[model samples]
Target: MSPAVPIPEDVREEVLSLAREGVPRNEITRRTGVSTASVSRICGGPDGVSFDRSATAAAVQARVVDLKAARIGLAASVLDDVQLARQRMHGAEDNRAFLDGAKAVAALAGTHVRLVAVDKDDSSDTEAAKSMLGKLAQALGVAAGEDADQAEDGGVA
Candidate 1:
């Protein structure tokens, strides 16, 4: 048999992290420049670490909260734009300018409405994510207060 090739520490860690995040073995191999057999060896069976789904769930929840905040901010900006467009439409000096301003108002208003529709109170989901994250930290022997503080400060732990 040929001598075994030693994978780099960084590459091995990258494979492990990708696998934990639910990346397919082939995808991890492609991303990390690791061989398929090596990727499989690093991410499968008893010798391999199982996927950390709790981490993924927590990440997704954090992302959702961030997206909601962004949407609310975008909606506010769109509303401001709509107001400006309406003013411009009313003060337009020509038919073409008036039509352009009116179209801008309509488009901005529609965008604002869609953005507002996506903004919601996800307090329950936030709480659940916090709870799950705390549990995961506990399982990993980490201090819960540290992560809790991070969560309260709007950072994902």
Candidate 2:
């Protein structure tokens, strides 16, 4: 058998840091240039460290917060577009201008509707928010893994 390679302490610590931040093991391996086996061993091997789930929960919450901010900014931009379209329509001096402005307003309104829609099955952000909620619950010890799964299915958990 080949001799085992010894990973430096700093590298192992980096691996643990990434895991605590909710980074996947494969991604940690890729980013740190470490072997997958080494990364896994550092993360949760028999002698490895058990990290605080709260760090992961915090990371997920941050992502959700950032996503919400981006959506708000986009909604504002769409509203501005709609307002411009309305002004153009009102100030139109000819039939063609009015028609173009009307079309712009219709398209902007549709985009705004889509941005604000919260259909769970069709919205990826809804799913991400749900996942963040479950992770937070788990971190807070409010629900075990199976209980969280049941809660997602609409059963009491």
Candidate 3:
């Protein structure tokens, strides 16, 4: 939708009214009895979808910030009534609610996780090393030790 293209005054007004309210183009077209072409023109061509960094981009970037802010606010509010937020032994439901709220607080306040990368493990060398160690230990009359006490498990001294 290219807003740059001129629409008829009536169509332009109608489009703006519906658009400001977040109405879908199809709905706008249906309601206004206007063609999709007219709606697209009033919307600023789809090809020229310009998101001003300070506006649209900022809004997208701050979405998480907004969500965290809301979450923190709600988490705080959940405790305003001290009685409800208080923990009582044998109160599984209340405890669960409190723990859930605490988790939300932790999430909003903590350093969240991020995945770095994933690579395949080449275990041929590790297996070969382990086999050599077991053979050497057996030849030396030393206990190769339990399966859990292997090099890969960091259990070998």
Q: Candidate 1 clashing pairs?
A: none
Candidate 2 lDDT by residue in tens digits, 1-157 = 9998888999888888888887877788899999877787788865465545586799999998888778878978999999999999989999999999999999999998887763236577778999999999877785487689899999898
- Candidate 2 regions exceeding 4 Å error are 1-36, 118-157
Best by lDDT: 1
Per-residue alpha-carbon lDDT of candidate 3 for residues 1-157, written as tens digits (9 for 90 to 100): 8555445788777776787777777788899878877777766754333222365577887996776676555655544433342333224467676677555545433322211111215487579889999999796655445543676587654
Q: Can you write out model 1's per-residue Cα lDDT over 9-106, one digit (the tens) per residue?
A: 88888888888788866778789889888887887755576654686699999999998888899899989899999999999999999999999999
Residue pairs with clashing backbones, model 3 = 1-44, 1-45, 1-46, 2-44, 2-45, 3-44
TM-score of each: 0.47, 0.51, 0.25
Poorest lDDT segment (10 consecutive residues) of candidate 3: 111-120
What ranking of all candidate models by TM-score puts the best one first? 2, 1, 3
lDDT ranking of the models: 1, 2, 3
Model 3 bad stretches (over 4 Å): 1-7, 45-157
How many clashes in candidate 3?
6
